[model samples]
Target: MQVELNSIWQLKDLDGLNDGLYRVLQLYPQDQIVIVFPLVDSKTLQRPIKVGFEQLNEALRVGKAHLSSYELPYYQLQSEANISASHLAKRNEKYSLIADLISSPRFLLDLVEQPRIKLVSLHAKKHNTYVQNLYRVLNLYWKYGQEKNALLPSYKNSGGRGKSRVAGTKKRGSPVQLSCPSFQAPEGVNTTESDKVLFIRAMKQFGLKGEKVRYSRVYDKMLKEYYSDELIAAEAESRNALIPSYRAFIYWIKKLFPAEKLIRKQTNQGDFDRNKRGLRGAATDHTEVPGSCFELDATVLDVHIVSEFQRNHVLGRPTVYCVVDKESRMIVGLHVSMEYASWRAGRQALINSFTSKKEYCAEFGIEIEEDDWPCNHIPQRLLCDRGEFICKDAEDLAVPLIGHLSIAPPYRAELKGIVEHRFNILNEKLVHELLGTTKGRSYIRSDKDPRLDATFTLREITKLLIDEVLEHNSSIFKDLAKQSALIIESNLPPTPLNYWKVHVEAQRHALSRVDEAHARSRLLPISKVTMTSKGIRLNDQMYYDSSHSDFNDWKVIARNNGSWPLEALIDHDNSSFIYVRLEKESGFTRCNLMRESVNFSHRHQADILFFEDWIKLEKSKAKPTAKSIERYQRRNQVIKSAKEELAQAPSLDSKSERTNGMKARRREAILAQRLGEEKPELKQENSFSEFDVYKEHSDHKKQKVVSMLKRKQVERDEN
Candidate 1:
């Protein structure tokens, strides 16, 4: 009565399965012919298989069509019956005899007239339970008098119905649906929501990593389109809920957006933190070869270098970016620049890393040999943090310069832990002991702490930093396991001078010009031609006679940046955007969409701005009255910062600082930042040293801006 099905190929052993069948004179002389097979495999029982009986009989072979993976096989039709090979194999001899007897056509025809045959029982997980349940519910709803689309069966509202059984709605007549977070990210969790982890995961699933940059704009497009759609269950972003302290918000925003910046954090907990002390954790090293990867990041000067440039823009404190071969921990490029950190600075880091050039050759009083590093096989990967200088726009300066560029995962500073940990050690052993009686400058104030001043300044600090780096490479880290201060063979395997020696002659020729340009070129100054509403013009001279043909119906704007390698801009006649002509590319590239949604946003902004500007104009036009608009200016800057942070997902353990400038392959990151540094601007200005002084006096600037804004608010309130 019961049998199991197994591999169909076993049927080849039976004469009943032969393609050219012979009518043998049987002793039973039965009319029906039956072929029985037993299930001997789990796969056969789990799924169904259907093979054309005629084809199997004709082929007489165990091939693809005659044998399918799905094994649950049985057929019975007028005077004929068949069972799977698995079933036949599993059946008892008595059942085998019955199968032989049923092989007669007469018996098969008679067996087909029988009312029914039964299956013994179904096994667990063999059933599609959810689909079955769904079908059952649908059948019952249709068969019974259950009202269509109603949450409850045969229930009525407003008449004589029992109280409803669900949250938010009675279960009687109304259809009920519940809204919840897509996943279980907390209601106020800003990190998960804004970081687009789910979206990014989907991208990874679909192999859309590189495509995300372009597709992300599509998402922005969608968000704008659905701006008015009801999105409930969202927390009302507030200053109080998020803005823990001014410091926290500043920290949060600093890590958002073009979220790469030279990071400087000190972790003295060394090899004792829960992380380092934990078990043999996931051993993560993407390097396939010893020197395949070279990671570089900059830390604040544990010690500074004195300014040596003619203009002598005293760096005050010098910083250096060191490239370390992950496997050997060799110093590839060791560059110590003054106060300026530019996109060019990042290129210098990369170039110096590979080529190992030195600006301080005279100071060292030695001509270091070139490294002659392999040119054909560039480092497989460049590892960097999100820093303005490194990951400047779409081109991602570091990535294109090498084969692959991998960002240190957000907050998982451990991925680049070597660099980070080394910096930490530098801070502890070198920077800490070297402060001496000298004082480091207070970032928050212009004045130095008397303790700090007698201790350290620009010259001494820079010198100390240089010495620390040299000492760190020349000594420490060779034996971290060693406790005592002892001489060790820690060394820069390939010095800056030696790096260039290994580079191939062809590579030398190819990158020689470009590399030199990268080093010394005025990156931010380049030539460009533009047209006003009138026509195509370069430096006010018309290049094209009139805006016609290619120039016809195109408007242009002067894009200012690099003063050489001329570029131009053109307006599109039909599209909702403009285009740019670059130094290399033949076609004009398009820009961000300022379309219907953007127009709508602008209009909405205009309404609010109109109200604001109106209020300002009205304040100038007329004096205050009892019902006058109260100027609550500068009331909640701290709160605004909190809101922005709260708009972010919850903090991961670490963060970075970066700026959004043009996503160009080559840019002067020094000047390539949004004019508004996403910070509340103050009246403080210094034309040449504006950015420099602001950075130097950041804390003082912060305090002054906060105070000045409050004062301005009070003055407005008084009027």
Candidate 2:
């Protein structure tokens, strides 16, 4: 009896294929019939049928069948009279089981050969747990069987046994050595736990002795227990390596290849160079505004804050701020202070520059007629970038305070070349040279030992910066500033500064801090107080009271409210209130005298001016009334009870000669402080005759200068 299959029925044995085909063919009409199939590899289709490896066999093409389980090379069917595909497929084509291939039992019986009375034998394939190895099972009960699983046979002594080197019954505490076995490694072998267990079971099913796997049994145990999914997945992918779909490819790749290899495949060139150029371009343009540009940066100077002059006690590296002028190339107002670089520091820098500029103008024989910003008359401008210290809150405080200032675009540093160029020079000549050639990043550390100060002191550095700026402004140092200004004045049609003037005049009034609004606010009160760091309002205009710590940025606290007798309210935080300075020198003097008066007997009972005056007045007065004496006694009792004061007063005249020197020194110090005159350094030696110069001078030059100084006669005798 014979049955028919299509041109592409690939199989490993005829046991199932022959019976199925013979049964199906007998159900077809008595004549030969045909079926079509696609070309494919049979091994690939061993399980659920590999679509990519299908094939059309010529045996099936000839209305016959072959049970060879492999693929054939061909495409498209040749002759197909009885072969009809699934109703939806193309005519005369392919391996769609369009019709029933497996016949019924009755139909298959009718085609059987009568003489031999043959019945078909079927080998059914099913998925089940493969239990081949039985040694592992036997080891569970037999200790000798378990011991037999070792790589090296265990040695048994009279009393005890030593563990084997390769085939230990127990696991090692340290890392197990890894090695390949003597046997050939399995193809598509999963070097994982589950696969190892399966391999052991398979060997047991055959009743084999300990069969050495290609990899270590220790690793196999680890893989079986800990890496089942990975092992299964790896085995599946190895078995399905020929699949065409992306899912199949990825599954295999994930198992066989490292993750980094996939990443490398995804990335490309050309993207790297583009990013590098963008970063470099960003660092060059450091600022934002034009001539209205100033770089206000803070750093700690190379000095400790514990010095006698700086005991006010600020924290960390005491900060120093600088507002650099673009055009003048000058550090206008620099604060070597503890405070942050804020709007206040910015104002200080601007005010400092203008104050110095005023001096400059005065030197040039141009007395300022109007105390205006000189926006037009002086042709001055403020230039800087957008920063908290320079233009905080978007210049909410800066623009109005710095009159006639123009702001540049953010990050457009080339527009403010004056400052940038000056900073470049500073970096090359000052900061770099100071910090050290190796200090690539520009930073100033306030350490006791700063490398920059080896040749330059703090005072010297400040002087050098100032002198450099002055030299820049002068007809010296190559005259870049003068040349640039001249070139702008001569060419470029009109520079930004010159052209900006037209726009500035329109905005100039708005830039002033002192105006109608300020006047109504009572910003103006008095003007005669020497202009200083604390700017006071007077006549709707702010004036610098020079008496208030000239070069320092003072946080001037005002007292009570804005009123008469304006003074520095030094101990308050409210800046809006008017400052009222008490007569410090006089109060100080009185306090000192009172302290002396308490110890009058210490001076040999002789009294000083204030104390003597008090005593004389007391002695000359009439005797106190009963009520007055009682009140005085009560006050004395209270004073004595409150403090553990001395019992007796001092004698004042005991140190008369010593007192004269102190008095003279005090008087001189007071005079010098008030007059703002500097004194010369006093030499330790008193060898010089002060009157010798007077004696040498002509009558016209001398003429009893200073009542013919006391040293005159002494000098004459010595000569």
Candidate 3:
């Protein structure tokens, strides 16, 4: 007899029990009530039975359990109040009989075995025992339980009964209606077309920007202006349906218009545009293979990062540029710097995308495998917006290296949504949780200054970005629809790494290592400069290799046209070195600035700017002076004397020193050798020929140095 919700339960045999199946609808523990419906016929069900769980348990213990089961019929829900009110208002005779049958459940149960049930009505002259009336009462009980409203007749009077009752016509009760009313409208004046127009005008006024009038205020205004005291009285006297109840008017307003559409119409263009696409409608399925479409975009990072070199120097917000593969929704590459979104930043981000991230991770002390971030290949198509993306620098580099570069229309951010979404994911995973983060809109932002709360340096934030990117790529997304049989069969989880491996790996087109190096070389800015006797002149600085090889090797070419304009690749970040390739060389050679000691060596663009400012300040303070040659010579002599003294003096530790006894013996041996050994060696074993020495020094005699002609003549003579 115990049952679970929405489960099929069979009643045990009892003396008064009917043979049927019961479905548990709802259960109340404290009341021990188990409401169920009995399926008397195959399709239709009897009244929903309200039996106590304890009583059912007792019956089940004493009687045998039935095994047959049945499916519960679908019951549509509808309010019975209107029908019941109408029936009571009409003083219908059938309403009393139906109410009595529904109220007396035991009587209804007794009549279940009876062929017909007697209906006693005050309007009826004799007792009516029609099976149809009994069936109607039983059907109401089954559908709507024992509620008094269930006995009320339907509102629709559809029977074709003539209005004039003839004398010969059989006496009958009023026809019962089963159809629901078309409009269960409130008791109020109906609104007219003119009123709707007025309401629209009111809505427009209320929805104005910065005004944002409340609905209650708008309603009051409508009452004061459109439905004035004079109009209300006139409409009431004429029984005109002009003014509507507040509730009904509000309902009509909601039914006629949607909130989102209204907001879009009244809001600013920026917010309106976003509302037009919204969150749901903007998504586009990426079925293309990875590397075919890549989105490139940049955003200012929300978190504040300080300079690693200077702690107090808060670097402000750094711009982060990312390239996202559309197919896998993976962040292929990212660049974070204090620099804004410029072509230089975009170029660096592109290079990162085409290079393995393992080395990059190692730089940040994050141990990651090459496979963990497999997005190193150049994309077939690069998608970007119309910022630095269309600049000359990007065009020059991408045209030769990448397969294609595409520029999206202005204000169409959805075109590069993958990278935009990647930026959001990065913010959520790393930036928002960090200290000194402006997490939301400017108006809603906290009063506390994020710069003051900043804890991590630029390098530390870079590490955090790397970790977040790794997790984003490898973590299971679970966003793919599970209904696809192909996905289920593949057994691959919805992760960027998995998607890349499953779909993009098989037909992946990648650049070779040599090609990658060539691409990198071509991507850098190229400048044509002349090679002089000193070296390649770049601006005010002279650049050359250590052996002055560039001057020697390219000097002949410069001599051909008096000046050689060779192509030099320059990185603005580092000023000390520039790359130059000779006519015969396959790759460029790095040339360093000649006077590095005077210029403070290689410097980045920022350092160079600072250096230029220092030079300006120095020039402003410095004054020209005249000096005597004698004084200059005297100063040079003092420097020369200092250098000579340093060279002649023995160092602190001398290899010539020995112990006192060893030194004495060494001195005695040296003295003995100086006295006798020199005399024994007086007879020279051999001596250089005086004639040959005199010939080498003689003015008349000459000797030819070794030459190719001389070597050829000597070879012929020997043969």
Candidate 4:
């Protein structure tokens, strides 16, 4: 092998030379001689020695001399920009002195041709370095690569960074100050191995997990447990104990246990994962376009609302459900109802998201163009919380509408943060300012009750919510990070409407169209309703009927036999109609509430169920009343008296004897009953004047004769 300059080699079994690693400093191939520098673990400079080329070649041929791998220094691997400015200035200054000599072509030749002692002496004199700075710079250059940055000072090794120093007898940092002259402080003590053991015990017992006690408490407990004797003596003498300070204890604790590990130990797994853990990625990383994913969640609003039927009767806070698109951060659907947050209310929100919004807004008395709040398509995937979506029914119903249903783990609200954050925006913007808001009254006493001030009905609150949703859709998004190509090209503001419109126009959305009737039927909650002879019965309270041809036949069959049950889809928000699946091959048929269940029409299913339960409870309460028991006993007594009267009468021996004088007895009984009743007396009247009476009689006779003549004439005309 050919020997090159600055190449390290291990010399073994070499004649008249000690076995060690050596580096070739200068090469003289024409003279058959070379200068080698010994590599050793010492900062002291070693003199280079000249050696014959043939001897080195023979050693290498026999495998006695071979190239050795050199590990790079830490400073060599670091970037030059990271080095301190002072260090860089000093490095440049050192390199400037030896620049001409190193850049010359005869520098290596001179190292081989000139005597080593004379060369060192001349460089020391030329550089005016009595302490051998010239030799140090040259040595660093040859030890590392032949680069200017190689002359940089090793300042990283000077301060003993990242290393623990052995404890001395005295203190380590500046002395502490006393608050007063009478108050004595502890004699500063350096941290020792024994003190560290006590710190570990205290941290494990009091500071690490279970209950998060304060650091001061841990320090006090440590002193009481580990240095009790010293503490007692100090207290007795009116002085402080000679123990490690709280700062030193905290230092060792942090050194032993990391902050993240301590946090995990202190909190529960769910809390730590939800609150303290670092976010692994964004929720929208997998979603490429609008409608790719949607988040569904519900929250109880802060304001109280009144019932639609009775405005004076204040219903408690209403629950609002919002579905937000993950890509655009837009609320695609919204629902506000008196019912609590459950699957019954959640499905209404989903139905709103999958159907048209024009008619829905119109029903709320908030007319809007289609583009005002235009989000009426099913998403590819739906992400929801575990409350309403972690059930078999939710999966069975929503999976077919939206391509997939993803339920987030319990307590992990961040998984559906898009919708969860929308609740805060809504409360801040609208609900908190309402008349009967309970936002700040939860923990404090107020002069007036919020319920008494409630004025907005449920329908009115819903209209306000729809208006807010429209405004939110058109408002600019403050935290929108991802943008589509079409949005960037058009340079539109980052509003949900803009993002949605541009993507839809370019056909970059993942929205899919579904039949509104099919979606509504599938999303409605299913329950068994009896097919009765009168009509279809729901929950044994509400009755329904359909105009379908088979319904009449089914009713007839039910009348002949017993009532049979069938599965029907129920819309909990409105009891006016229910969708019934008659056959496997047919779609759902709409059934209207019957006249018998007219009280339940336009009422919430929850209200109807509540009424039924309340009525049953009232009946149960009234059953054991004293009045009811007395009435029952009085009826039994009356029946007993009638039976006795019947027994007193004689019995007929044969049918002929019983029927002998039935008609005569009935007439006699009728006459006897009439005779027992009283009759009214008649009154008489008379005239006193004779002339007046005679004149009245004459005029009456004349009128009668004229009438007779007129009647005869009429008869003759008819003949």
Candidate 5:
């Protein structure tokens, strides 16, 4: 019988229970109960009991107890009774009902006055029983004052050691315990110990390593080779026997060669080396301080998104590049796009780590304060894997701007565990809960297709990511800070924002005004361009500004050559301008595209890619529409107009090529001119062209004719 814990039982149901009111603490093969008496200490009732009968009867009459109800409980006891001290105590006569009933005043008085009141079994009317004689033994219990002496029968050898047994009666002895058996070697048929050794060795050689042999084939071959002297049985009872069973042979093979050892023997050295390295401590100690170290990595976001420009078109997964500060375990920067992890995406993520994110978040439609993500400082060192950071382009772009750049060994991700763990944290807490999420692996995902369920566009996902990152930064790091000594040193609340505030002042790589400009320019994607009078060319467009100091510096470096190749850096997020470095100077000059309002209207990289792809798709058709051609023609017209304006303007001579005497004369004339006086406007026709030498034909045509004559003269001279 079983009773539930903390439940009220009826008085009639208390017949089989112990004589006390009990609170059910646990239930299993037997009930675990505690007495609920108001006068006694609850600590004294800490010991569990099998039953409490009188306590239950009193509780049913009172209706309720002072103790609170147990809401949830678990009961786990042994399924089978084993010989323990508690079980032996329950069988003692002191707590037994027979002793209680016999010791009652009415039963004792009746038994003492009438010696003829015979003991008989209640269930069987004709037979006397141990229960009926309990009354007669109660008198001896008062004299002995001990349960053992009172319960023992008067007859010797109580367990029937020398008692006579009936002819049909069955005998029983003390029970023996059962347990699992030990392993034993299986003997081969018709083989001695030496032959068995040879057989086992042959089995291992044929099937264990190198080239594997089918166990069925080994069994068949063994049967054919049996009865030979080298493979003969030695036992007398079964001297000549058949081959052992296939199952038994396979079992022995498994016992001799374990799976783990076999895999280690067959696998390559690289796998073993990786496993050994993973067991050691981290190769880097980046938890010194916030902004002292950062890790850069990229992963495909779990949710599928569509192009913001095209609603029906399903863009696949977006690659999310993250830059994580090692000490605070906070994401310093993140960039999301359709491009895979490369130098382009890596540089963007790197720049974002050092730049204020307020405007970046605003561009994605999220309004966040700057202090919420106060991680806009240059880091002392950058850590990355052997992907983009190993490339020459990444090194050239990052090495000059940052202090130290280190790449972890191939196939070792634990070195950059900070960023990798943040990716996992984002996927679990944010991505998995959103719509169109793959929810990780196929076996783990539900039946719904992630691509079909996609509803958010790339723009929408960017906004969601901004909000998620902001929440992650501000949220309490209760578990992480409790374990990290560096985070606890901040002496503030355990959160990324709080930790950063306490430690940001200690950063050694704080950026100055000039250093900040240099860092931003270096992280932008670079392009080689020829410096023309109009400016540097990029993406089929010319970016120019005469007021730029770098333009004058570039002239000094390329005084002899009309045009020289120089690297121009571009901001992919803002196509409004570019930054170019002078060949002779260290500073960067921002150059705006010549006619942005007409042709390249300050569009982002995503829109540019869309336009290029759209043109390609239109051209792939058999015939393109007039509108498509007109759009292409309009773009070309704007570029052609900017060139015509630049060509018609007066060319300025290189100041570096001018003599010192000529510079002095020009400076005197500029000083003599009044500040407010207007200079005379020049007409389209030149006032001095009337006296020109080649006025009859245009100067260009005259130069062409002279070039023809000169070529003929050179040909005759060569002949």
Candidate 6:
């Protein structure tokens, strides 16, 4: 057998030689002898041995020696990807020195053929000691497959990594430095086995628990529990010198307990599972395609807004509900209203998502083509938080529109991170810069109030939000867009709209259509409305009228049998119309507010409710005023005066007399009251007419008297 360079040979039962592995460094074919070196520690320099080819072949045939290929250990095979920049640079430097020695065949053969000691002496004389032994370089080159990375230092074995050192009398770490020159630092103590036990006990007692505890507190507890009473009674300096320091305790605690373990133990199980745990998979991994899943979430906007009707009246922050597609990260639907974050508001958002966007945008005075914002279908599954989508009503409505309803566990916002993150984007991109924005106001002390700065009405803000949504949907989303295989194949820019369009064209979407009216009726919140004699009363404030055939009949029945309640679906965003269900089997009947409730037309239920609350507040404020008190006092006085008059008035002698001339007495009293109340000026103007009437009576009497004894002179005295 011929001995080849860089071939490792293990001698088993060789006489007069220790059995070990050796590498063939150089071959001398003319002499039939090979130069070989022991593959031992690179730090030790060993002279190469010359072995005859016949002798190696005879040993191999006798099974006393074996030929084996050299393989690098796992730790020695470091890839460039895993290497740090500094370590890689160091490795490259080492490889550069020996690059020619390993690569050039003639130079390597001539260099390794020289006598080993003479070679080392020559290298040392030339000051070219990149390695301790030139023969060891060849040994490693042969051992690790002759790669540039083969020269990398075994840093993994340095610094006693992952090994605990035995405690001794001498200190192990840097000495503590005192901040003040006058202060004396405590003498360091080696962390003994007992101290490690104390640290473990303290960490298990305090640090590793649901409630977060300070390391300082844990150290104190350990010192109190483990230190003897005599040690505790010692001076602070002496006690610290005898016992382990807080820093030592911390070092051991960290060594025993990893950061992840401590964090898991110190945080709530839900919080840890939701936020601190590693994300093994993505939301898109579960959503197979666009519209496969929609995430719903609502947030109170940072900016204050005014009422649509009254711009000067700040309506406070409005709740904005957003629906995001899990696969494409598109803002499929949105609802902004003064209503609080409730199922009612979230339902409107879902309805908006399921219906066409063209008409919805038109309502906000924004004109756009169908393709500009073309997310108008129900998703196969809906993922949402426990807030709005966990209720029975939501389950009933949403489970039908979306085939599956996924209610995320409480406190896990990451489950609906798609929509929750959209809210942050909306606030950052659009809301934070708007007038009356409350962002950063918490830390500001300026006299300017965000509420007072509110200039945009609810409608104006809604329009702006629609425009933002359009822009956001069209904007390029680098992370989400580039993740799509279809978009990459099509070489399209990764905007949400582009991604959605690509998938839709490829028929890789799970969107389904539902009747708009049916979706609206099912998703809108349901409430009970009373059918009264006057009209259908809603919330006992606004009344509605339906033109159905049974409307009048229901009204008649209600009037005769007292007010009755019927189930109705209300769109909280619009108080103008409500869908009323008169019968169990019948569909929802559209009802408009009665004429009496015209004031509440085109208004939100929140606005009407707020107005009612404002009115109540005003009444409450007015009730305690001086004028109100005086009015009540006057009313009491009138009652007292009427009681006094009744007491003074005479009683009828009999019931028969009281009824005998009731009509004549009433007429007389009315005539007396009219005369007493007549103005003086009117009385003077009528005086001449009265006198003329008296004169006519006298003349008539005189004429009659003349016929009767001529002259009684009608002296009738006009009597």
In lDDT terms, which candidate is top? 4
Instruction: Give the Cα lDDT of each candidate.
Output: 0.38, 0.35, 0.64, 0.79, 0.61, 0.78
lDDT (tens digit, per residue) of candidate 5 on 1-719:
23444443332234444443344433333332332211122323122233345454465557533233322111112222443445446436333535544444344333333544543244124333454344344333332232433333333445796443432223222223345456433443422344446457656555455443677876666655553443454344454354445555665556556666555554455555555333555433535566667888999999988765676678888889999887777889888877887887788787777777886777666777888777677777888877878988778878777768989887767668778888898998899988889888663445767788888876678778888888888788675565445556656678877777665565423332225457777777557766765566565444555456567766555555677777677666655666777554656766666653335444456656876787689778758679989999999999999999989987668866546478556644563353224444432243335325334455567567443345344445554
Cα lDDT for residue 450, candidate 6: 86
- For candidate 1, give the lDDT of residue 288: 31
Best by TM-score: 4
TM-score of each: 0.29, 0.27, 0.50, 0.68, 0.48, 0.63
Task: Put down candidate 3 lDDT per residue, 526-582, tens digits, no spaces.
Answer: 678668655677655545543444467566656565766777776553456667765
Off by over 4 Å in 5: 1-278, 281-286, 442-449, 478-491, 506-514, 528-567, 574-577, 580-586, 591-604, 619-719
Off by over 4 Å in 1: 1-284, 303-317, 338-344, 363-378, 389-396, 435-471, 474-719
Residue-level lDDT of model 6, residues 1-719, one tens digit each, is 65676788898766545688888777778877676766675565565566777777778899878887666777566667897788688667666555655565454345445644354355444556744645555555655656666666677678998998888788888888778999887676788997788788878887788968999988877777778664656764454437777788878888988888899998898888777899987767887789888988888889988876568888888888899999899999988887777887888988889878987787666888899998889898888878787788987777876889888887888878788878888888989999999883473675678898898877678889999889888888888754678888889889899999999999999998878768877777668888888778987689999888777888888889998788888876567788888788988888888889888876766678778887888788774678888999999999999999999989988989768978757755675566568898876687567656756876798787433455453333543
Q: Over 4 Å off in model 4, which ranges? A: 1-88, 97-157, 178-188, 236-239, 251-256, 312-315, 337-342, 440-442, 445-457, 528-567, 582-584, 591-603, 610-719
- The regions of model 6 sitting more than 4 angstroms off are 1-161, 175-187, 211-214, 228-240, 305-316, 337-340, 440-461, 489-491, 525-567, 581-586, 589-598, 614-719
Better of 4 and 6 by TM-score: 4
Higher-TM-score candidate among 1 and 3? Answer: 3
Pairwise TM-score winner, candidates 1 and 5: 5
Show model 3 residue runs off by greater than 4 Å.
1-190, 204-248, 258-264, 268-273, 276-284, 362-369, 390-401, 440-446, 455-457, 480-493, 508-514, 521-523, 527-566, 570-579, 582-719
Instruction: Let me know the TM-score candidate 4 reaches against the reference structure.
Output: 0.68
- What's the true lDDT of residue 107 in model 2? 24
Give per-residue CA lDDT, model 1, range 564-659, as digits (tens).
Answer: 233533221111222344326454443333232232121111123334555578789896654443333344666788899887956545443232
What is the Cα-based TM-score of model 2?
Answer: 0.27
TM-score of 5: 0.48
Q: Distance from true position, residue 81, model 6, in Å? A: 14
